[model samples]
Structure formats: structure tokens, C-alpha cells
Target: MKLGIFLLAAQFEAGDQGTVLTSAMDAGCAAEEAGFDEAWIAEHHFVPYGLCPSAVTFAAMLLGRTDRLRVGTAISVLPNTHPVALGEQAALLDQLSGGRFTLGIGRGGPWVDLEVFGSGIERYDEEGWAESVDLLMRWLTLRRVGAEGKHFRFRPVPVVPRPLTRPHPPAIIACTSATSAALAARQGLPMLLGMHADDCEKAEMISAYDAAARACGRDPRGVEHAAASVALVADSRAEAVRELKAALPRWLNRGLSAHQTVDGRARTMRDPHAYTDYLCEIHPVGTPRDVIAALRRTTEATGIRRHLLFAEGAGRPERTLDNIHRLGKEVLPEIRADAEQ
Candidate 1:
């Protein structure tokens, strides 16, 4: 099994965006030094929820900064940019980075990002996501491509630079719902399961994905799916939970409130405090032993081989770094040993 850090670059304290971004980059470098596999970055637009607006761009910067650590986007919001344009950048990064880049695409919310990026709210639905993925796959896999989908229409054009990883750099789809999981399965792409879902829920989603893949004449066993989980390390579970509960709620509430619906539609936001509690309950917010056990149980239940650990739950740079170090030094060796067994 592979383990990586999920870099949210979220601003929790009263400070400039630069500090959050720098801390995030430092975390990525620290992951490499600590012997983790990769670092996945989260993208957000016009919101302080995540300061990195372009995951691909941020990934390129981090790739240059680290020698062995693979860099990827937790998701590059598909609705906000043209698939071909995004593909070109992904290909370029993959080629330049020696194929160490992973592209995780997703259908982001109906936020004001759509209006600002000129994609409109129509692209927030299933059909739009499907079309974008189709075009993206074609661009990545084929020498030339054209799009006649409802969301995009284009004449055939050559795929420039081409991808270093045949068919494209490893790509995954962020699956938040059954429809999204099925969509990924049909395409034979791996699913990037979010942090909010529990082991049981992830197991169910994986089962559904397998069924969908079988229906599409794809072998599910070959797909290496990834799951994200909030992680923190302390001497005891209570201390970890206490640290996360105090700061994560404030960060969550602040960031959640920053989102604005593009169409003025009412959006229900999760209660930050309650959501934090649920995350602690479901994820690896505990001591080294507890974290390793939870991660092992999750992998066993869901058949997920890769994990993106969101250690930023501590909501402070120092605490987050400490968590990552403990995860890499104390927890990782045990997890790898268990996997070998």
C-alpha cells in the first residue's frame, strides 16, 4: 500500500495566503524527507477554503522542490477549465516531472467559480462531468482529439508533447456519489474517495464500483483506488482529538462560509463542530498505534491500496508538520510491514 499527504493549504489563522502556501510546500518536502510516497494537493477558487487555486501549477512547483516525492492534484476542478487545455498542462507536468504527476479530476460544486471561469452552472451536473472526462481521456490517450459534447465542441487537434506515461499520467476521479463512482468505473479510472466517508461507506462504494466496472467489461482488480482520511498523531487518542476539535472547526466553518452559489440557490452547509467530531470518529486521529490500526482496517474493508492522509486537520503549520513526521516515521513502517504480511 502507498501513503501520501493531502495538502489542503487552508488558511486557518489571521495571516497572508503566502504563509499557508509556503507551509504546504514545506509539508510536501517534509513528506519526501520522511519517506512518504506522494503529496496530493487540493484546489479551490475564489475561496480561502483552499488557497491554491491551481493544483496543477502548485504540483509543478512542488515537483521541482522535491526529488522523490510524487505530486498530484486531489482534484483539478474540471468544470472551471477546458479539458484539452487542462490536459496539455497535465501532460507537460507529467513529462517534465519524469512522470511523477497524477491528475485527479472532479466535478466541483455550483460555486461562483463556474460563473467566474465562464463554465456556467450547467457543468456542475453528471452529464457535464462525463463529457469533460471523455474529452480529457481522449486527449491523454490518443494522438489527436476532437470534442462534440454538449459542454464543449472542438475540431480535431494534435495532442502536443504527448504524455510520458502511456495513455496519460495516472489519473483518478473524485467519487463523492454513486453516480461519480459509476462514472469512474465505466471509464476504468480509479476512484479518489473523499475523507468524510467511513470504512463501511467506502466498502459499499468500492463494491458498487466493482459491479459497475464488471458491467463495463473492465476488471476491477487492476484498478488501484485511493481513499483520503484526516490524520493526526499524539501520545494518546484524546489529545489528538482534542487538538483537532479545537482548531479544525474554526477553519472548517470559516472556509465553508466563504463559498457562494453561482445561481443564488440555497446550499446547506455542514455544522463545522459536528463535522469535526464525525471526522475524528471516522479517521485516524489518534496515537501511532491507533492510526496504523485504523488505516489497516480501512484498507482491509475497502480494498483501497493508496491513502492520502490529510494531516492538516490540526489547522496549524507546526502541528501539521509534527503529525506528518509521526505518520511517516512511526506509523508508515508498521503499515508497510502489515501490508507485506
Candidate 2:
């Protein structure tokens, strides 16, 4: 049961960007000290949703502070950036983390995000994402790889530095659909299940990932499945709820609102009416006991190996830090250490 702490460095308040970033840094340091396996930073743009336009840059900042924690972008939207350039950036980050970088990539979905990148709504479809990822994989491994399909072809120069970790670090996908899961399975990359509601959904997604992998003649052992359920752990369920009410709008609203605008499709979380209805059902936002019970239930249902907890607070870093310490000291030990089990 490997636990991860998820961080997103977004400008929540209008002022003090540096101060907010420092708080995020402090949170990462706290996560490392709390004995978690990783701290995943997310990527976003031109919005208060997430100020972290460059997640690898954020990784470099954490590498200097934490000893063992692997620094990763929860998922870098590959379609928006040239894979070749991002591959080089990831290589540098892999070295910076002392080979502790995990490469998590996804196709940007928030309609606005895709629009910004000049990719249309049709690009959000599975085929588009698959094409983008396939090209990315080829470019990262074989510099001159050429393709004549629906998407990409690049004149190749062998990308230098070539990543410090074998096969260019473990690859992960931020999963949204069965098609995406199938791609992850076929490619033997782990699925980072996003936008799920609870334990039942997670278990179902894990099964889906493994099934897709096995069906593709890929080893199930090579297909890692994990999910980040927004948890605000505290001493009591009441306090957890209070904290969640205050903090959760930042994560859920930001996440659910993010989908791609390809194929003439532009979407927005612009519908504020849906926020409350969506989060209440999906997010785990209570005490330690409530979180543990919810997580155990979800794990039992989903069979996920890794759990990433996305949580942080400005005025109460202590509470966030305390939650992680308790998670490391208590939550992980109770779960069977072997992921395969």
C-alpha cells in the first residue's frame, strides 16, 4: 500500500504568488518527512485552477528538499506540448530527482485548455489521445521514429540525455474512459484514474485496466493501477468535513471542469450549479476513521495498489502535515504491504 501526497501549486488568492508557492513547497517537504512514497504535482494554465504551468520545474524545487520521495506531474498534458521537447524536460527532471521521477502524461481535456493549444474538440476522443501518446512513446525511445497515421510525424534527432531511468521512467496515464484504460493496458503504462466517485468506481477501474492489459497480451504485472481520492483526514469526522468544505472546492471544481475542446466541442465547469452535486458524492472528506473506512472499502472494491491523497491548506499546514504523518504511521501499515495481494 504505497501512499502519495498530491500537490497543485495554483494561485488561489489574487496576490502573493510567491507566498502560495512557498506554502506548496512546505507541503511537499512535509509529505517527504511523513514517509510517503511520492508527491505528485499537477499541471494547469491561465486559470486560478492551477498556476503550475510547468510541473517538471516544480519537481526540481522539491528534489532539493526531499530525500526519497519521487516527484512527478500527476499528468502532463502531452498534446499541448511537443513530445520531443517535453521528453527532454522529463529527462532533466528524472536526473534532478536522482532517478526518482515518474512520467505521467495525459491529453488535455478542459475545452479551454485544448482551445488554448489550438487542438479542436475532436482531438479529445480516444483515437486522438492514443495517437499523441503513441508518437510520444516512439519519440522518447527512438528519436527518429516516423508515423503516417491520423496525428504526428517528426524529423528525428536522437534525443540526448535520454532519461536516467530505464525506458524513460515509469509511464502513467490520467485515465478518464475505457478507451484510455485500454491504451494504458496495451502500452503497459499504469492508469491514474481521475474523476471517479468512490471505492466501487476505483475497484471497477482497476479491474478495467488489468483486463484491458491482459486482453492486449500485456503482462498484468506490468500494468499498475492507482487512484487519487481527495481525502481530508483529521482527528474526527467533523473536523475533516469542516476542512474539506473549505478546501475541496479548489480540487474538485478544478478537476471536473477540466475537459478538452477538440472536435468543435468546447466545455466548461462554467456550470457552477453542478459543483456541489458532483463533489459530495465523489470526494472523501471526513475524519481519519471515515477516510480509512472509505479507502479500505474502495480498495476492497477496486484492488488498487497505490493511493494518492490530494490535500493541503494555507492557514493550516499543520493539520495537513498531521494528516499525512498519521497516514504514514497508521493508514499504510494496516494495509497489506504487497501491492499484488
Which numbered prediction scores highest in lDDT against the true structure? 1
lDDT of each: 0.90, 0.69
The worst-scoring run of ten residues by lDDT in candidate 2 lies at 268-277
RMSD of 1: 1.0
Lowest-scoring 10 consecutive residues by lDDT in candidate 1? 120-129
* RMSD values, in order shown: 1.0, 3.4
Off by over 4 Å in 1: none
- TM-score to native of every candidate shown: 0.98, 0.85
TM-score top scorer = 1
Candidate 1 achieves a global lDDT of 0.90
Model 2 misplaced regions, further than 4 Å: 10-12, 119-123, 147-149, 250-284, 313-318, 335-341
lDDT of 1 by residue, 173-226 (tens): 999888888999988899999988999889889988999999998889968999
Task: Please give the TM-score that candidate 1 achieves against the real structure.
Answer: 0.98
